[model samples]
Target: MTERTFDSATSGPIVLGLSLPVGSVRVQVIESLITARVVLHTDDSTGPAADAVNRARSEQNGQVFGIEVPDMPNGVIVRGDRGTVVQSVGNMSFVGGTVRINGRVVSGGMGNMPTVSPIEATVCLPAGSSFGLAGTSADAEVFGYVDRMEFRSVSGDLDADGVRQLTANTTSGDINVGRVTEQITAHSVSGDIEVRLYDGSAATLNTTSGDIEMQATGAASGHVSAHSISGDVRLAGARHLSVSADSVSSRIRR
Candidate 1:
């Protein structure tokens, strides 16, 4: 296990980016933190790959943004020499004023090299920070009082709460969002989407082959547009609003 911390007094929101082969990631906000922290926990397989696995480590922490697990070797032989199975569990990195995270595991060599263990990460950030998080084939859970947020994933579910403005895009992953103050734009392909909003908040939700559910509270005048191809669309609560819902073979319940 390796841990690193960064000290920064920048007065801007932090931005984060992450790339993982197969693992789960989480990001949270801390209010009283003045610095950022990153921890990496790795477990390597025994036998001939042990030494090579030990060499497969993350890059040094950067002042601005950092990524765990150095760049994969280009040649197949070079990659094989660096161990084909190194995994990170509970790998965490903390940042302030714009940060990004990126990671990926490669599988090579003959004869069962043991499935690449799923890598998980937990990121704690300061409140009121603007962030951007991205990953592939990994579920992500993010929350905190954020000014603006952008999230992208493929084949991984996403859940977010308490954000002012949000933009999310996913493929084959469910999306659940709560309490957006300004506006939200979410798009999904073959995955369900759920959104909750207050009065005077606008949203656009679309899905294909998945359900779309929305709930608005109070006498909201927000404009909501929801569309689905072969899935159900449902809207409940709130009066005095403009809503446009569409569906092909599924019911559009209001």
Candidate 2:
């Protein structure tokens, strides 16, 4: 249960990367003094496997967030370390200007593996930063004004709002977005997609067995293209210009 914070730049665009295996992740954009927070949890306290788990937790704990300078051209990466900090929690870093955040959750066990559910990791980023989020089997929620946003999930529901450009992919989990101002590219396998566009530029939504529903402002002049194999496509209040919808057997309503 150790916590640490890092310092970042002051101004400019920031990129965020987040990865987790099983626990939920919540990200908030605020005009604050900090960049982000990372929490790692494991069964290192009390268990027959406590010693082994504690050794692993100590090695991989604070290694979650890595920063790259101009050499790498503004980047952040999140993934598992050398099998240490897979279950421990609490690591934070602060940076400005093109911030990138990366997180990961791995599976491991000790002799007497504790039956503790992973704690949720909450991150706070600067407002209006470019962001990227990734997760597997853990639900994610993001709120902020992003210049550009990218998200990937597997069987994890995602919710976001106040984004300018969005690229998202999901499998077997729902995606809900609000107030998209520029464009959106979304893909889903068996999860539904719902988006509300205030001033849309373009949208490409694809799903295999999940429904797609989108709404644009009446004054929108953007183009919308949607495809689904066995799911419905519903569009409301979108401009009648340059719109395309396709489905195999489900209904397509505009």
| Full-model lDDT for every candidate | 0.62, 0.62
Q: Which candidate achieves the best TM-score against the true structure?
A: 1
For residues 1-254, could you state the per-residue lDDT of candidate 1 as single tens digits? 32233333343345544554444667777888555443333343432223332433333233344443332222211122223433332222324422222322323322222333334566666666665656655577776767777778777787877677888888998988777677888899999988776444788889999999877777456788899999999987744568888999999988
Residue pairs with colliding backbones in model 1 are 14-98, 15-98, 15-99, 16-99, 17-100, 17-101, 18-101, 19-102, 19-103, 58-69
Tell me each candidate's TM-score.
0.70, 0.68
Q: What lDDT is obtained when candidate 1 is compared to the true structure? A: 0.62
Q: What tens-digit string does per-residue lDDT give for candidate 2 at 110-208?
A: 222233333355666666666666655557788777778787877778788778888999898888998788888999999999997657788899999
Off by over 4 Å in 2: 1-13, 32-114
For candidate 2, the lDDT comes to 0.62
Worst 10 residues of 2 by lDDT: 68-77
Candidate 2 TM-score versus the reference: 0.68
Number of clashes recorded per candidate: 10, 25
